[model samples]
Target: MAAHMKEQTVKVKTRPDYSKQLITDIRWLLWAVTIGGLLLAAYCIHNGYVGSLPWLSAMVGLPWTAHGVVCSFYLNMAKSDHKEGGITFESAKANSFVADETNTEGPMG
Candidate 1:
């Protein structure tokens, strides 16, 4: 009776998406930089390094922290709202890329 039954097989993709992995790694890097910068700033203040050179740590760390914050903001803004279905293209972006009559500057008048 078992011989009369047929067997079925399923195939799966062998290749992995490296781009997705790279994106995830980059996100982790942003978090690391933010935390590292804050720690470095704290260390500099605690050890009185600011007495000799006040702006060194701030110059180095603040930009990195700001960069991480910017990245996080964009990331959050980009997340799709599954519950709400999705965002409309017009509402998602404040400005449209489509050309309008106002932009008249050209290579030749």
Candidate 2:
């Protein structure tokens, strides 16, 4: 019968992972910052804001742009790999304490 043939059992699978989404978010933020900094620098240059203040423009724009570049590099690195899900903890108190407790003072003391 057609009804009997269509009554086969089905197994449902779990949802896909979201690590790729995390990396995508990081990359999007980095590019947004980079573009924003470049835009601000261009605005300053266009309005001749650098005529009276030389180092001010560089001080604000340079560091932000550099930070954006670094963030972009980190985003690229994060994109190269997919993270696997590790063991799940039953409760918060399951692994509350550290195995080693060696707290020492100053650099060489």
Candidate 3:
């Protein structure tokens, strides 16, 4: 006779979702960099040093790049929200004024 062996199932714990927190942190860091870059750009422009063109361009570009990244993040969030059945302003408005089928009174009556 063969002995029967019992198998045990172990449940694995999942890590909490940190994607939103990570995105928020990244946005904050980018905004900080954008502010710092704009300030540096202003300083570079005011000083008008001959060889500072590269530095000025880099400083100016940094803020624009940061802005673009933040905007892209927002766009991605909106797209994901729409895909996930999240309600939007337009959807809310359309859903708000659903005609009541049971109503028999006319507007003139």
Candidate 4:
């Protein structure tokens, strides 16, 4: 009973430093873009544009990779803030103003 009471009194802290995590994620994405770009360049040089369709596709996809990485980094960092207590319904409704529900038939009908 005493041991159980002591265990219950102990507290556990689990604070995670997400700043470094975001940096590491962005760094990995940067490395991916660099490696993909180099591979595309090599393919372009070795096979020429006519035969480098696959490499061209990879090259086209590289920009999107960077964009997605940055977007995700921002999203993570933004979500780390706990002060706001999450998005409000008013803001969501204000930003999204669509038509209200309506019957498939005419309003009179």
Candidate 5:
């Protein structure tokens, strides 16, 4: 007679999603820099150090530029997630039935 052998499976752990936290941190940092830059610019203008106005403006604008870039990245991520069958806002809209000129009777029809 042959001996019976037992098999066992091991479980793996997955890392927690930190994207939301990271974005929140980035948002706070951007707000801080923008507000601080504005205050510094105002101080410089008050003391007649107008020569640094342009630089200050650029400093303040940096956060807005970074926000735009972050938005683009988020858009791309949403697109990729939709393609992967993830439930995103775009996917929900796509799956919903809406009566439009192109679809006279909607999805049911």
Candidate 6:
């Protein structure tokens, strides 16, 4: 027997202006630790504190490269979808109160 599938449209979430929220979600602690690790690695190597410890400097490289790749993917997606007439945050917020259905009151006596 053969099976059939029906096509459905998906509402993809897109943010018109994402910079502010992105800035708010940054992990400062992670950055500090990564940079501190690299600096410590340099210090140890400079002081001739040799061992495999210097390799810690590369600890941050992979994650940063991965982050760049992921960000690039999102940017490309946004560029490709730039022609879409998506609603902006401010407009969505303003329109949210119009049909909230919070007060489904019965007919007044």
Badly placed stretches (over 4 Å) of model 3 are 1-16, 55-109
lDDT of all the models against the reference?
Answer: 0.54, 0.52, 0.60, 0.57, 0.66, 0.56
Ranked by TM-score from best down, the candidates are 5, 6, 3, 2, 1, 4
Model 5 earns a TM-score of 0.56
Question: Residue by residue across 1-109, what tens digits does model 5's lDDT show?
Answer: 3367556544444332365455667788889989999899888878888463777778878777987788688667756766646665455578673533332332112
The superposed Cα distance between candidate 2 and the true structure at residue 78, in angstroms, equals 9.8
lDDT of 3 at 6: 61
* Total clashes in model 2, counting residue pairs 3 or more apart in sequence or in different chains: 0
Model 6 lDDT tens row, 1-109:
3368666656554443454245324345448768888788889889998578635746766556655665677666555544434333344456762643433433210
State TM-scores per candidate. Answer: 0.35, 0.35, 0.37, 0.33, 0.56, 0.43
Model 2: CA > 4 A from native: 1-16, 51-109
Per-residue error at 43 for model 1, in Å? 0.5
Lowest summed-lDDT stretch of 10 residues in model 3?
100-109
Ranking by lDDT: 5, 3, 4, 6, 1, 2
Query: For model 4, what is the alpha-carbon lDDT of residue 51?
Result: 51
lDDT of 1 by residue, 1-109 (tens): 3888887544443333353444556667766776776677788879887465445556556766766676566456546421233453444343453543443433211
TM-score between model 1 and native: 0.35
Clash counts for the predictions, in order: 0, 0, 0, 0, 0, 0
State the lDDT of candidate 2 residue by residue for 1-109, as single tens digits.
5865776554444333354444456567666766766677688889887565545556556655866676576555544432322222222134553332233222212
* Top candidate when judged by lDDT against the true structure: 5
Query: Where is model 5 more than 4 Å wrong at Cα?
Result: 1-16, 84-109
